[model samples]
Target: MKNLILLLVTLLFIAGCTSNKTEFKISNNGVEAQVLQLKNHQISYTVKKDGHVIIDTSLIGIVVNEKSLGSNSKIRLSERFSEEFDYSMFGGKNTAYHKTNISKFEIKEKDGFTWFLEFLVSAEGVAYRYIVPGTGTQDVKGELSSFRFPNNTKVWYFERNNDWKLKSHAGEWLCSDISQMPAISKMGPVQGLTLTCEMPAGGYALVAEAALYNYSGMRLEAIGDNTFKANFAEGEKGFEIEGDILTPWRCILLADDLNSLVNNTLVPSLNPKPDGRLFADMSWIKPGKAAWYWWSGKFSTFEAEKRTVDNAEKLGFEYTMVDEGWERWSNKWETITELCNYAKNKNVGIFLWKHSNQLNFPENGYALMAGFLDSLKQTGAVGVKVDFMNGETKSLIDFDEALLKLAAERKLMVNFHGCQQSSGEYRTYPNEVSREGIRGVELNNMKEGPLSASHNAALPFTRYVTGHADYTPLAFTAPGETTWAHQLATLVCYYSPFQCIAENPEYLLKTQKIQPAINFINEVPSVWDETFVLPQSKIGELAILARRKGNDWYLGVLSAGEKKQLQVNCNFLKEGNYSAEIFSDDILAEPVPLEGLNPRANLTKRNTAIPFKKEVIICDKNNNLMLNIAANGGAVIWFKAREK
Candidate 1:
């Protein structure tokens, strides 16, 4: 009887061991994630950087039509593959993105309905999505994705507002406790589109949605305790898939610093490649500077609009953006057609604005929009800016996709103003060059003192991390609020493909103090060949970004705090001598009127917006350079490699 009892105990112990199961791991470039499939189909994963825990067993799964995917998922045919590919960009950091290391896992589920979950692991981060093979339709009840971080993690929270007009105050990124999730609201207090976490190990991890096609945009719900759940704008059972559907990529970008975070191309790399045929000779899709008119007030007459276009030509701007109210001119069609022709003769293009909701209005809206775009094409209008797309619902997402596809068909470049953050769509449609998702210069117009230097300093590390921001930069403000040099530096600091020079043309030519900066701005390429973020930079305090367009390097340094000195390391430059032009705050210049002076003046002009000092420096194999930036001020440096 004793021998039989011992045998029974041994069998029970074996059963317990089988139930616990061993963990599965996927890793690349010293980053690792261990995944476990728990009881009731729950999927949990913990991310490790260099074998140190960063993400602690985060829950991730989905629910379909009120049924949980975690209820009973049987993994079938698990396979892994890695591929390396390269791509060139018309407008982005570097002309070409080097090889991408894609490690993918394809798993089949088996709990009645047939579906697949594919997880892509890369050196930069992780992304996963669901695929329904040959589907009729699937009603998604909701997603069960949650991010649980270590208690020490902190975040830069952006309280989102569903209403488009309320987006201005959302620009400021406030550092906050990870455990405190803001209350959910359709109006305010929502988390940012990208929730960046400061890791305990001195690294960074960013969470955002990618390839957001046919799905509602994803937001994060802080459920407390260093935990956040993926929340879609769509309610339970709101998302439906039809005919071989693939879901959007839910991604997390991991990096060692703010620079690496800014430099990571993981989001676009995860998107579908742009079909060359869709663009049909993308050579005409020019990415350059535009002179915008709305900020200076409505140019309701052809003559008023003509002066703006003339200023654009004077400043060598490639385009003049004719905003709303242009339709009020007598003989509107003739006036616009004449303006386009005039701009073309002056070697400048035109971008027109249209209200997004107007296109959605009843019977005539869609037809009218289509017809207007066709007319614009005939009128030689190069681009269109669609504004006021207030929400991130599925319907709006669908509408945006449709509009972009149509715009591509018409061979017109597009800019989405007052819209949601970009979801890597530019990878698939090259014509969609820029979008306004941040609270930019337009906010400064509403409240004079709010979009301060600190807000500008934080933008690169925050908003620009997600994608290009149409901040409509270079607006003038009170002398005590932001220095003239800071405004001038922004044109180089911010990355916008269809960059808008927010100042009036008259200001660019008349601002005598900023002309030297203006000359550099005129030639500054909208896209970059390379980018470097200085190590000494701090979020919300200072930012120093250096970018290369061909052999020329543009350095933009901004300080939101007290005056301080910083260094620019040019070790990344080719081993050779170069001539550098420095535009910085004039320590001795007389102060001008701090009020009523147009803030949107062409800053590169001397005495244009704020008085500045310009100097020429020569580098003799010493790449290290230093400068003193004033409080609420900044600097712009142009380095050109000398001919051998």
Candidate 2:
């Protein structure tokens, strides 16, 4: 009888423990997150695709003023909501992208400090944020958000190249298996905006952030065995959080295939809709190619810029950037107006540049910027490229947003340079088309700063995972560092709404040797309706991208290490006849190879331009074509579907 009583007691104890924990399931499009909310205890979660776990039990919480948020907290309330984004980002990838997601959880913690730990799960991935409500102010001492992967997970990431360490969120793409993973403290800070993980559970995930506002930028730091914790920028001190605080949405972009990973719109979907009342006339914003003199080793002058506008018109480009040196022109504003007028006749828009610091003075910053922007708009300029804002403190973020709003007020587009990673800012403010958080092509001006073929190959998978980077691609100033064909391929592979081409006027418009490449550049569209990362692509080795604008499909294949044959198939096309225009490295006109002695240098210096060849062919849905690419070379194929 005594034994039976004891057994009943034991069973009740087990029941009590189970009842204390509640599992709230939020799922969509095969991606699901099960958040286990412990009553008055620490909270944790597990993310899964179908039934397989992509993220093991991971902790998610934030501490305010040294008080634990998730731990020793009560779930005072919970609710559900749905959101839909039907409008388009005027200057982004898709013309009109539709999104729907379900929201779960809004917990209340100590002293009416009602903070809702909300999660939005969409088909692309999961995004969550902490919405803390209060009256006065709050100090966020720490963020305990972390992603704990399986012991054998492989992470494809990059080291922080700038002084921001990982804060800059820009560098050469890299990958690491178990042996190369650095220790927690020694790893400094790694990329947080977008970091890819080859899950041990048979899928892929990209860790990133979205909708950043009034907060310091985030960088991930190795915290444990195959785990990374969210670390805020170190210099972001005393950032006052007043009223209701909405933290940035931490995003997990998931996919079963490389194509899905590359095309997921979770990052942008998390951002709030653009202010309809502010930007009622979205037609003013346009996305197209541009010609710039920066990478041409030439400075812009009044007459010189007119010549560039002519080059832009000749190449069928929609815009030309006067760049930094135009201010040095005597009677700068008048010269700018004259250049803008000249370009206006040829239907080419003009872009101007400004030092970010000049717009930061508290005394007359707003007045100066407003006056200048108004005057510049009067001069027929279309946009401004604000440069040298290399930090991510909350103050800097505030200024950046202010600039975008100011620029937008005058119907001007803004491109930020020396900036932090694009945390889906373009989604909210589409007028800010692109940013140079990336180490772009202009670095070739340095004797030792030329980019390698492998680095360019890795770009689409790594750096571009965030958003449009103003890489200013297809520069021929440092020829033979990569084949001109390779440079041409970048114009297609890279994503920039501004699509700024930095090739000099002479070679791009006059030289017949590279006319095929130039023609290919002029034909491809800047944005696409569809993008497919071909199965042949291997990160850091090769990039095979198939993109479609209207009914025409363009396939760009870039080879990194050595001379090799890359094939293209018509499977990506619909069932119909298509005429394909192929531009490739000229087999009969390869660069003259010289005996190389320097072991450190990757490519031998060449003084002459590398030649290319173009071919026209008819293909069907089942056709396959194989073409040889020289070392550090590439090819482009534009397939136009025939009329029925």
TM value for model 1:
0.90
lDDT of 1 by residue, 260-374 (tens): 8778787777778887678768876888899877775644467877888898888888988888887677877777889999999999999988888777542443566677789
Q: After superposition, how far is residue 153 of candidate 2 from its true place, in Å?
A: 2.1
Over 4 Å off, model 2: 1-20, 38-40, 90-101, 110-112, 160-168, 178-187, 235-238, 362-365, 479-481, 592-610
- Runs in model 1 with CA error above 4 Å? 1-22, 96-111, 160-170, 183-189, 361-368, 477-480, 599-610, 621-623
Candidate 1: residue 47 Cα off by (Å): 1.8
The digit string of per-residue lDDT tens for model 2 on 339-407 reads 898899999999899888888753555777787789889999999998887777676787788888889
Give me the overall lDDT of model 2: 0.73
